[model samples]
Target: MASMELTDGYDEECFRTIVLAGSPQELRERRIACQSILLEQLNVIPIEEWMFRVNTMHDLIAETAVLICEAQMKEAGYGPPPCTYSFIVFGSSGRQEATLWSDQDNGLIVEGEPDGEKNRYFEFFGIMLSDLLEEVGYEKCAGKVMCSQGMWRKTLSEWKEQLKEWRTQLEWEPIRYLIISSDMRHVAGSTELSALWQKAFYEGFIDNEELSVAVLRNTVRHKATLNLLGQVLTERFGDYAGGFDIKYGVYIPLVNIVRRLSLLHRIRASSTLERIEELERLHKYQHLDDIQRAFLLAMRMRVNTPFSVQNGLLISSDYIAESELKNKQLLSELRESLLLVRRLHRALQRQLRSAERWRT
Candidate 1:
């Protein structure tokens, strides 16, 4: 398909005109049309610019979903949300790094107590919003992280208490939740609620050594994709045999390391690139330019392919057919990127260890 011409630039007005121009059903259809334009334009735009475009498209979809939920609530006589709430997205969407077929990972933070009536109201709207999002193309999160889930949709005090529990427990599951919650960004509704949630989360890590160690442990849990022989590892078995798990094997480790360091540095930026830039500005890390370039290259590769959900997890293939892998130049670039990931991982580990020593 020929790429869409970008004459007027990507703005909210253009987004509304294209994706929100018609009836509810028609709006859902138009949202997919907008995605098609974005996918096509992905081929021509710079990787960074393309990522921004994708995020904007996601924001538009979420806003439209919120509108749908509002309409539904009005029809049911709920009369909009009872209390101020922030629709917060986590994972890639939260970091403004969504790929072409990203699934939803979001939740809600409402002001005041989670009374029975108010809880029911938000719960109904949450399910409505998730359903609308799925209809428009974004898949529901497999982890049940969406606002439709009771565990995710909570009052501000409830969320603060939850964070405290996670910090106190410091178990594997709780630590995992803490890390995931770290990436949340406010998509709609009250920004104050979102800020309060963030404050609670960041404060949990302040001068907390045990929490820092838990984060470090989780951050290094995954092994790099490159083996000791420096060969890129492919899936040994499965439908994706001979294909690389780029999402987990490369992108995730980089994200984890950057996120951990960002938290340690008290930088609140969620995007991996943004965290790296902040670390560089703080003179905290060395050779950030190369690391950023490699990270961007990996992102470009992942976004170039269509994403799929398998076993309820979002997966993308990095499979270069053996025939294609025989192309010396292409092979070299792929190997170089994988090696850079390994190098960056090692560098991050060293920095963390050094920080631990300094802390003592």
Candidate 2:
């Protein structure tokens, strides 16, 4: 029988080398290798420990992948392409809150003619980068909304036109498009691209007669969660177990509402929590009281609960039964805040309907 030799501290040294000190290209390769190692070790460790290891590995890997792609472009003599391009990450990645299964949602913006070949080059780069990511275990976006997808990859001029059309039209499809576009954040590429487009789009869209209506109409798409009498229909999957799909149900709604408000006020912040804080400082929207703020905080906390797949899957959260919340006063405050948000949603729906009538 062959005896296995003990390799003391080998794993720790490997983890540090891969996640922290390596150059961009080396980090990318090492991180991918670390993921494979963690996956193989999953059966030997407890689920909770495995979750921590995998998530840490993933965070480092994602950052490394981005860096490596940038390095590749620089090495190709493109040297960051142009000063007027931006890599905008949308959806979960934009929020910096990703689960193991989350796919990519990203776009690219280059300041150039809409129909030119430069735009094609940006698309080509994005496609190649996304293909590499897929090979590293980060699956490509299923809806074809990634930067590699023509629908998302565009020149700055093209995006501005798209935004203009959506704002002017005030139709369902246009509104839906804007909703996704609104949540975008500049993750990489030309730094000023995001700010420039944001300035133009906000100036053109906010408080516009047609655009406001479009946004309000889009807000009501979450109506299925609102029961006949206007109660929030909590999901059965986690409610009985003292949990909820905070991601889809509560967090998404909060984010959507913030999206509408930010668009209305032309708030430039991307994340919901940041938008709330920024709006509070602006002092224009005083509807969010301390109680409401606390509620939003609680909801945000619930939304950030971590999860991972070990054997089958493991999801964990700060979610507790309505009766089990430790801070009763805090919970009470949050509940009130949630009601305020509900009212806001209703008011927006009414505004949209009125606008529709006026337009007709």
Which candidate number maximizes TM-score? 1
Task: RMSD for all candidates, in order, please.
Answer: 4.3, 9.2
lDDT of 2 by residue, 127-175 (tens): 7678766655566777776878877877788888888887777778877
Q: What's model 1's TM-score?
A: 0.89
Tell me the deviation in Å of residue 254 in model 1. 1.0
TM-score versus the correct structure, for each prediction: 0.89, 0.68
Query: How does candidate 1 score on lDDT?
Result: 0.77
Off by over 4 Å in 1: 1-7, 10-14, 18-24, 306-324, 347-360
Whole-model Cα lDDT of every candidate shown, in order: 0.77, 0.62
lDDT of 2 at 180: 76
